[model samples]
Target: MHIQLVRHATLRVAYKGRTLLVDPMLSLAGELPATVNTPNQRPNPGVELPMPAEEVLGGVDAILITHTHTDHLDEAAVKQLPKHLPIFCQPPDREKLQNHGFEQVIVVESEYVWEGIQLYRTGGRHGTGEIGEKMGPVSGFVLQAEGEPTLYLAGDTIWCEEVEHALKSHRPDVIVPFAGAAHFLVGDPITMTKEDIVQLAQAAPGSQVFVAHMEVWNHCLLSRDELREHLTNNHLSERVQVPQDGEKIEYKR
Candidate 1:
């Protein structure tokens, strides 16, 4: 299996002879405005796409969206992706994608199968307290296919009971956690902080944890250096990988 960090929250994954694009935020750097109610108000997408947009989208068999947030599925992606491509998303986002003119919007309610890949929808809390409640519903996904390693993509969530449950139930071979410690001014981090990441690693010692959603947006406070440093301090660096933008990591099952 292969996974490429295509920028913040966006991932290009290859497994079971199929390529999937997850949460594609394809806008050029500075093309979008900053995230509101955050510390840094600088234009979003602090850096450019490491490769050309075409190259990033090339040979994608399907698209998987965790939610309808602009950062996850932006205007650029809506414009670039082919209308005929099958899109897998939660039920809440079905109407939104249909409104955007996508022809195939498959809602993964609990579980769904496409070709040889099996997708299982899981729950997540975007934040805590009122902020989390207001952030609305979010989801994570588990992918399994014959001759391929099980993969768990924990989308836009902190370390919570739901995540722990997924870890215990799925026992994934690889785990991707969105770890930026992103927050607004009033609330605690809306994404996984360093401590949360550590807890996750400890929870599932056997799974390889890959960090994503860092340093690209104004709201995300945790940088790659900081996360790596924390992991090194905790003696969990060897188990976790923090890839740079457009960097691809390969794994054998």
Candidate 2:
């Protein structure tokens, strides 16, 4: 299987002769308003997409949207992606996408099969207490296919018990964590911190972890440099990857 980091949380997963686009924030820079009260409350995204949206969207067989957050699925994605393409998303986001006029919006509460790939929705806590509640419903996914790497795409979630459970239960070969320590400056991080990354690495020694959701978003406080540095200090540089935009990583097992 191959996964390309388009930008932010957007990724292109290729497996079994098919391609799936995940959390496509397919819009030009500065098109959307800034995230208010955050470190970079300036209009997002702070940088341009590394590749053209059309180029990235090419040949995508399906869409796996973790949630409805604009950073994951922006206005442009809603307008640009083919209306007929099948969209696999969480149950909470079913009506929202349907309202956007998509025809094949499949809500996978537990698991769903597309062609030959398996998609299982996993739980996480966006934040704790009141802040967490305001963050809305979110989900991660565990995908597996014959001859392809078992992938655990951890969505916009911080380090929590559910995360630990997912790691133990799935034992995925490849894991993608939205590891930007994203926060709007009012509350604690809404995503995993550097320490969280270290913990995940220690727990899942066999999993190839990819760190994402940094640099592009205004609220993402942790940079790739910091993440890399921390991991290196902890002797985890070889296991975890912090990919650049438009960079593709392939697992040939």
Number of the top lDDT candidate: 1
lDDT by residue (1-253, candidate 1, tens digit) is 9999999999999989999999999998999999888899999789999999999899999999999898899999999998899999999999999999999999999999999899999999999999999999999999998889899999999999999999999999999999999999998898999999999999999989889999998999899999999999999999899999988998777
Q: Per-residue lDDT of 52-166 in model 2, one digit per residue for the tens?
A: 8899899999999999999999999999999899999999999999999999999998999889998899999898778899999899999988988899999999989988999
Worst 10 residues of 2 by lDDT: 34-43
Candidate 1 off by > 4 Å: none
TM-score of each: 0.99, 0.98
Per-residue lDDT, model 1, residue 92, is 98
lDDT of 1: 0.94
Cα RMSD (Å) per model?
0.6, 0.9
Best by TM-score: 1
